[model samples]
Target: MRIAILGAGSIAYGNAALLASLGHEPVLWSPSGRSAGSLANGEPLVAQGAIEGRFRMDVARSIAEAVGSAEVVLFALPANGHRMAMDAAAPHFKPGQVAIISSHTSFSGLYLARAIAERGLDIPVVVWGTTVTAGRRAGDAAVNVSTVRAKVDMATIPVSAAARGLKICQVLFGERFVERADALAISLSNLNPQNHLGIALCNFTRMEHGETWGQNENNTDSVGRLLEALDAERIAIAEAAGYTVRTIREHYHLSFHVEPGPVGEMARELAARGNGGNGPTSTDTRYVLEDAPFGLYPTVLLGRLTGREAKLHQAGIDIFSALYGRDFAGENDLLGPLGFADMTLAQLKALVRDGWPVEKAA
Candidate 1:
């Protein structure tokens, strides 16, 4: 299928490389325009790790042209670019177009639903809990994937369209796709933000002190315990909301080659498997920025509504915000943007069960 990857960062390049290798002609476009320009000019996209392949790409000037004939539009962009990217791509979206937000955090499908409603068009939007684990970037229209995730869990925005979404994903992602219960369930299941929050909270000083510091080895016993506390909060929210979450042990097994072990034990297992325990660990991590807005905020908000208090999760947010001297909650307009700001807890619950236009907005 013809595809368009909307981000030009490392994730974009990496995934684009895989698609190209799989015989899918993927048009590369970025808001920055550099990655697209580079690919369109017959530049070589460099491949480094995992699957190695090189190829040039067709680049488009606008989101419409980028996704003109794409049956599936895959967004490998960061959480920060998610909604804005959707708005930009909405004008180009036509009927039956499947837009997948990989590794999404936040209420992304709801945001997309709002955009689609605003445009008066209905399109299927599938939001994945996270991307397929592979990473890459373009140097000359080729990509480098250092590592790859074994499987990914995803859920559709409206909850009703999950079947259709999974069918399309299967054609492309194959067995990498695991159907989640719903978008809210997927939102909570995502561990990137949660994991990053723990690491960043513990290593903020390292990030502030120097760029060279690595927090890959910072998962101390206490840190592991804190991570468990946060995970328990997440699990509690999921259970209250009527879903069984993927445990930390299960998470470690997938992200790394280990079984369901403790956090610190899993870290050691990852190193033993040669993944090097080198996931994102810095101030620039989305755990605080993107996930907090897209991932954690939703978790916190849902937990409150679900009769669960994510104290450690909340504490992480508080400390991170204070250290940065920025109001993380205020920085994110997720609830407001989703039109849930004034809605009561009961009202939000109904919205999740039913799709948009839930009531006559007063």
Candidate 2:
């Protein structure tokens, strides 16, 4: 399969290498046109850690060129960039192509599906609860590929396309996808927001100080307790919404290949085995910026809709806002545009499951 990956960051590079390893052709497009410049100039993309290889991939300078000949189009960027990428690629996406959001956040999958629907195209948007590969860029054209998750929760819009989306993902990545009831279920299934909230709140000082620290090593008993508490709130919201999502312990165990245990213990175990990666070194890190608005804020919204109070999640957003001197909740560009704030619970559920412009009878 020829895959078009839109984003030239660590995730994009990591996925490109993974696809190349699987004997598939990948074309990369960096929105800024800078990240993929070296790769486009004939430099080989080097991937280390979990996926180790030197692979060559074509780099497309424009969105149309990238999605034009590809069977699969993957969005491998941050949540903040999803709208821009979708706006650029939606018109070019034809009927036969399948779109995969590496990790869905802030209901961005629904935003993309709506855009495609407006163009009269029925492209299956596969929304993953989390990314397939977790890693960071090591160099201009190199990525330290972290663990490719053992299991990833996924779902497709239009409800009826679930099976085809699963098969498409398995063919491109592997047999690691577990389909959920709907995009709403997958949205609630994302554990990053709650987990990251606990991690960032307890270690904000360390991050601001720019000290190099072990992410898992710092998951101390106190931090673990906080994480568990946050998880409880998230699970409560999920249950109220009538969906069952994974626990933090299960997330760590599955993503890092560790035994299921207490969240902090799992972190320590991962660090003991040399799999725990370093924590963020700067205040601009995604742990707070991306996850706060796109990850945490959405959980708060869901809590409101389901009549469950995500107090801790809301607190995280508030504190982060004060510390960063910006309104993280207001930072989500997709929510307002999609009119999520005015949506009723029933309408929101139908939209996610059935795609945009909900059926009149539904």
Candidate 3:
């Protein structure tokens, strides 16, 4: 399969290497053209750890070149980049081509759907609850993958393309993926926001001080308790909305290969096991910036949609906004322009199912 990776970050490099290892033609494009310079040289992206290889990948000089002949365009960037990627790829998307968000955060698929629909194009979007591989950048040209997940959960927008999208992903990655009912379940199933909230709150000092720290090892019992509370609220909201979201414990056991233990204990064990790398060294990182607005804020909005109280989810957003002196609530490009006040939960679900109408000229 020909795959176009829409980012040139660590995860993108790792995924590009993995795809190349699988004998798929993987091409990379970075928005800033930073990684593209190095990648364009055509030295194989060397990968180590869980997936080791010296694999060569093509680098697209522009977005048009990237999506031009690709069968699947994977957004391997962070949550914040989803909008940019969707916007850039919209014009080039073909009917039979599939776009998969490495992990769905908030309503990325819906936003992408709206963009494509506005252009009168129909593209199937496969949304994964989390990434298939977890790794960090070893250097400019290489990445260290800790582990390839045994299984990852996913769902497809419009709910009709689930089977086709899943088969494409399975064939490309050779990993098991459990398909859910719709994109809602897949979005809620993402454990990053709630998990990162606990990590950020508990280890605020380490992040602020710019100190070296292990991500999983710092998941102390107190932090675990808070994470559980946040998970409870998320699960409640999911259940109220008639979606099944996996608990944080189940996520840890499955995704991280942790044994039976408390969330905090399991985190520490996973850290000690050595696949888990160092956590974010700064507070300005995605744990607060991207996850708060894209992850937790949407979760809080979902709580309101379901008439469930997500005090922690709301409180986290407020705290971060105040701490950063930025209105985190307004950061979601996906939902901000949608006029949430005028829409009902059922209407929103319908929009997700059918798709929001294309915006009319003013």
Candidate 4:
């Protein structure tokens, strides 16, 4: 299948190479144009670690050009870009096109569905809990991946596209998708925000100071216990909502190759073994900026609706907001537009089970 990858980040480059290696035509496009321009002008995309190869992909200068002929559109960028990306690409989306958000968090599919509905288009939006592979940027169009996860959790919006979406993903990437019931369950399945919350709150100073400390090694016993507490809160919300989300322990084992153990000890072991402890080197990283608002705040919102208090999650958001002197929750495009205040818990659940309400205003 022809795939159009919308984004010019590490994840995008890595997946592009993987897809190309799998014999699929993968095209690249970036809203900013810089990343795509760089690749288009002849920056070869090189992959190392788990999947090794150097490949080149067609780069589209505009959203129309990207989705013009592609059967699949994958947003490999961060949660913040989901809204803008969907808006730009929705008009060009074909009737049977499959839309995917690799590592979907922060209700991205609902946001995409809203855009698709506004355009009166029929498209299946697939939400993956995490990317197939994890890696770091070696250069502008190069990525070094250390781990290719055995499987990643996923879900499709409208609940009816589950089978077709899963089949497409398994064919393109590999047979590694663990399908869930709805987007809410997939949202809770993402462990990055909560895990990063623990790391950020405990190691904020280290980030500010630009300390090159080991992220996993620094997760002392105290930090690990705190992480577990936060995970418990997240799991409680999932359980209250009747979805069985993965625990942080299982997350580490699946995503990072760490065995199941106490959160801190497993982290420490990963750090010592040099398997997967690397993280942000500065305070300006996504750990706080992206995760806190896009990831944690929505979680807090869900927790409150479910009558389950995600104290640590809410606390992280509050502390980060105060420290940064910005209302992080206000930054999310989905929440305010979602109009959670006007809707009840049942309505929200129905929306996730179904797709976005066509009558609702964007």
Candidate 5:
């Protein structure tokens, strides 16, 4: 299958490499055109670590060109860019095309579905709970894939399209995709927001000071306890919302292939095994910028709808807002536009399971 990846970050490059390795054609488009420029200029995309390969991929200069002839359009960018990417690609989406939001955030899948519906087209939006691979850009056309997740939770926007969506993902990515109840469940299933909150909050000083530290090593007993506490709040919200999402412990074990135990202990184990990657050296990271508003804010919204107050999640947002001098709560562009604040629990659930404009379903 031909796939159009809408980002040129490590995840996008890594996925492009993985797809090429699977004998599928993968084209990459960098919104800024800076990342993929080198690749477009005849440099072969190199992926090391978990996925090792040097392959040539077509670089698209525009969203229309990138997704024009692709069977699967994958949004592999940060949560903050979802809206802009969706709007740019909305008018160009062709029939019989499947959209996949790698590690979906902030109900962006619903937003994309609604945009496609407005065009009188119904495209299945596959939402993954987390990314398929974890890595960082090594160079302009090179990416270091840290690990390929063994299992990834996924769900389709419309509940009825679950099977087809899952099959398409599995066909391109392999059999590691696990189907969830719905997009809402997949939303709750993403542990990155809560996990990153604890990590970033606990290590804010290190990040701000640009100190080099080990991510898993710094997840000490104290940090682990905080992560566990945050996980409790997220899990409670998920349960109250009637979704059984994965715990942080299971997440660590599955993603890292480590023994499940206390969050800190697992981190220590990962560090001891030399798999614990380095922490962010700068303050401008997705931990706060993307996850705070896009990831945690949605969790907070869900908590309200489910009548479960995500105290820790909300506090993290407030604290991050103060630390960063930005109103993280108001940073989410999708919720306000989607009228999430005024949506009732029942209405929100129906919109996620069925596409937007509920009258169409009726």
Candidate 6:
């Protein structure tokens, strides 16, 4: 399988390396161009971790060149940056090519669907909430592979492309795809928002002060409670949106080595599993900044539109937005920015009842 990964971050490099090691042609691209240069020189650096047999592959020169006759154009960019990436990539999309958001968050495939439609183009989009596995960038061009996600919950935007989308993802990741009902479940299933909002908001000082902290180790019962609160908000949003989202605990046990435990217990164990001496680090992480806009905010909106109260979800957004001094509730959201603002509570309910083929646009 020919694959092109956008973004040269740890996640990108790690996945690229995996594809290359499997003898699949892999190409990497990034705006910074540094990672690309490194890869082109045949010396893409990779940081090792719990997962064995890891190495980085060289980055690609251009988007067109990177995807050179490749059927799968895999995007490793964060959910927050997906819109911009799609905008830049819309022109490059050719028919019969599958564009898989390596991990879709917050209606990403729908966003791409809208983008492609506006451009008068159509293609397959496979959207997965979390990556096929959990990994993090440890250093420049180096990423730590925590574990290959046991299951990748997914859904195509239109809900009609599941078969095609699943086939493409299976080809790339070797059968880790699990399709959901619609894009809404994918939005709710993204664990980064809940975990990040809780951790980053609670441990803002550590993040801002640049103090090194491990996730599973430092996250205590209190952090677990807060995260649970956040997760409840996410669940509330899903319920209100008429989608049954799996709890965080289910995601952890299903996606990682942790056996079934309470949501917080799973978090702690996951932290312990990640490298950082004892736990996953929270410092300068993508936990909040990356997930809030696409993950948290969307969950909050779903709650709002559905008449479900999501105090913690809303509070987390406010706290993080204040911390960053930016309106995390920007035009990047689905319920908010995508003209879903006009949707009344009852109207939103109606949409949920008419799922699968999408009755509103019907």
Cα TM-score per model: 0.90, 0.97, 0.95, 0.95, 0.98, 0.87
The lDDT values for all models are 0.72, 0.89, 0.84, 0.84, 0.90, 0.68
Clashing pairs in 2: none
Worst 10 residues of 2 by lDDT: 353-362
lDDT of candidate model 6 versus the reference: 0.68
Model 1 lDDT at residue 238: 86
Poorest lDDT segment (10 consecutive residues) of candidate 5: 353-362
Looking at model 5, residue 219 earns an lDDT score of 91
- Give a tens-digit lDDT track for model 4, residues 245-327: 88989888877777899988888887787766466778888788888889999898888889998888888999999999999
Ranking according to TM-score, highest score first: 5, 2, 3, 4, 1, 6
Residue 280 error for model 2, in Å?
0.7
For residues 45-145, could you state the per-residue lDDT of candidate 2 as single tens digits?
98999999899889997999999989999999999899999999988988898999989999999889988888777788999999899888998889998
Please give, for residues 26-110, the per-residue lDDT of candidate 3 as tens digits. 9999888877565578777889998988987789888999998899999999888988888888899877888888889978888
Better of 2 and 6 by lDDT: 2
Give the better candidate number (3 or 6) by lDDT.
3
Residue runs of model 4 more than 4 Å from their true location after superposition: 357-362
Cα lDDT tens digits for candidate 6, 1-362:
77878877766766776676666877778856665565466655564664555454646667766665576888887766677777677778777787878677666676576666665555667777787645666656566776666688877655666788787777766877777876667777887778877767777777676777776676677887887777887787778667787887787677775787666677667666553233224444567767777777767667777788778878877887777788877835444444566767565443322322322332
**Candidate 4 CA-lDDT value:** 0.84
TM-score of 3: 0.95
RMSD per candidate (Å) reads 2.6, 1.8, 1.9, 1.8, 1.5, 3.5
